[model samples]
Target chain A: MFTPLTVALAVAALALAVWCGWAAYRDQPTKDWHFIGMAVVSVLALAQLAVGIVRLAGGEDAAEGTVIFVAYLAAVAACVPVVGLISLTERTKWGSLTVAAGAVVLAVLQARLHEIWGGGGGA
Target chain B: MAPETPPREPRDPGGGPSDSDATARRASNAPARSAGIGKGPGTLLVTLYGIFTVGAASRSAVQLATRFDEAPLAYLLSAAAALVYAFITLSLVRGGERARRAALGCCCVELLGVLTVGTWTLVEPSAFPDATVWSDYGMGYLFIPVILPVTGLLWLRRSRSHGGPAAVGD
Candidate 1:
């Protein structure tokens, strides 16, 4: 696992969470720019997903359970896009909060991924 | 999104000739069609439940497939929890008087599951070598399992009393 990518994803996810939470606080829905932010984070997650698969194929970290590792990798990649779609349907402050919640969950998943990768679980 | 379909009129058992006109009046008298249980805060609840459905389902699936023998009870409980979450999520999305009632009932059941599992895990830790989604009242997941059902019940009850139409089999 690339430590830098995991770190970057955690940071980006938390940043997205704060940004979307601010939108909710202001009684605003997720606008286009917010979707863009979500896309950016999702792109990063995709990159992580690819790297994780490659690492798994190369048997870089086999002790942490490959099935669970692959599942988390896939889940992290899918998180933001799914939440973004749901937010698009719900055009309200709650929609913004939904994205915020997704971001937070993604961050937590990122930490879990780190742990699974045997990164010492230091978030 | 298009406005939710206005609830259909209740059918008359006698099949009277004037049933159509009566049904039309009844439909018109019904409250706002958009007051779905899946609207407003219900959206957030649905989102959370959707995430949990995926999370718990996948987690349990992997666990059950890979090592069911290690702790069969815990893995089975996780799978059951995932099913409950998925059902509640669907019921919320399919909002109406019936769906609301169904969701309400499911929420109570969910709350009961969480409490029972939470206490069981505490009182007999050795009984479960692996943790379930409802273990320790969902402490591992920030207690969202316990909180979600209570919130869901409140939301469902609120939607029901707010005159959400009683659509038959909708």
Candidate 2:
């Protein structure tokens, strides 16, 4: 994994999570701005995914097992979209909270992914 | 979806309703009338549980498939934790009186499992060559395994007080 990309993804995810959490605290449902934030984060994750796949195809291996690494990659890639769908199903402040939680999870996963790739970062 | 309507209180046959009685009825019915376990805040809870179910199940499956000989006990414990999470998630989404009871039972079991396994892992590090979901009180997963059941129990208790028509209040 690219360290800079990973860091960027984690930072973006955390920023979005905090924003969503603030909105939820104010008793607001998920708004267009939240989706936009998610889109930005998703784009970063997709880039990371593409980079990871290319590296794997080029015969690079993660320090951790390839299977679990790939699984985490796919999970990170899918996280935002899945949470977006869940938010749509709920049209309350809780829905925003759900998205916030998802973002936080994604951020944590990104950190784990970095460590799994032998980046030596703390989780 | 439209918000759930409160059920009308059964009228007294012999006399007109007093103001205090109507107030009492409304108060008692308020929370019960809100939503089933599958809706509102319950939706968010179920979503979190669902994520853990998938995460724990996949992790154990991978560990068992690849390195079972290394840490069979820990891997098996992880699998069991996954099962409990799955059951609780299902019950929460099912969201009837029966489902609530089932979830309550599972939550109790989950709390016991986490406590027992967490303590055991701490007391005997050699026993767990690898960490299970409950190891160190779920430190690996932000201690969610330890916290989830406590939150679940509280929610279940609140739901019970709101006692649906099919629910037998404790």
Candidate 3:
């Protein structure tokens, strides 16, 4: 079950990925461009983390809280920087492809995190 | 004939560079990777690997640290896989003969890890009470864990013959 925010972030990332792909077709991806794409992703991830915590705090309970919580933390930290650094180093089309890949991964993880919170046995 | 070495130029200016010369330039530039920028996809792949390493390691760390009792086998394996991802990412970024060799090793292990864990879990469900990154051949991550290593190895092999700095991807 994807949250509204998740859907929004995913869609935004997808759109950016498409644009980045076009940019790659054109050539050297500047750092400023990479920053814009990643900043959005970073914000969304943090929001998911916060919303996740709030929901968890509500005490719905059932899933393995330890595993779920830890995965959530990992998911949040992992998505943002990895994508950013990869783009920073890559000044060509592959960088855009990489961003696209990361975007896809981020969207998927966001959904997974949501499921973990909703208790689909993440822990 | 040795592959033509494209002059060491990181950024090509202006519009769609789909020409054969441009294509050749991009292709030939595979080994020249050192300090500063790399081609886009290489950048992205390296970044993705780095992310995977961090995410996997943290998950393994937390899993092992908090409750080794829960599923020690799976958790320990998860930690090991995370280390491999990190190593591969480093090799990709480092872009050298030795780094390439290290990446090759990591990729081989990754292939083995996914197969071993994935098959073990399926054949004996009792073994994997919880999922690790390689559980089900990284089905959770869309099996990229299985696919990536194969691709990495091929790339490394392909780059070896060319033997140019550009082949390295920084």
TM-score of chain A of each: 0.94, 0.95, 0.75
In model 1 chain B, the worst 10-residue window by lDDT is B7-16
**Poorest lDDT segment (10 consecutive residues) of candidate 2 chain A:** A114-123
Query: How many Å off is the CA of A53 in candidate 2?
Result: 0.5
**lDDT for model 1, on a 0 to 1 scale?**
0.80
lDDT of 3 at A57: 68
Model 1: residues with Cα > 4 Å off, grouped in runs: A119-123, B1-29, B32-35, B164-170
- The first chain of model 3 has a TM-score of 0.75
Per-residue error (Å), model 2, residue B15:
36
Residue-wise C-alpha lDDT for candidate 1, range A17-39, written one tens digit per residue: 99999987776778989999999
C-alpha RMSD values across all candidates:
8.5, 7.2, 5.3
Q: Residue A41's C-alpha lDDT in candidate 1?
A: 100
Where does model 2 exceed 4 Å of error? A119-123, B1-35, B164-170
Q: What is the iRMS for every candidate structure?
A: 14.1, 12.7, 3.2
Q: Encode model 2's per-residue lDDT on B129-151: one tens digit a residue.
A: 89999999888889989988998
DockQ of each: 0.30, 0.27, 0.50
* CAPRI docking class of candidate 2: acceptable
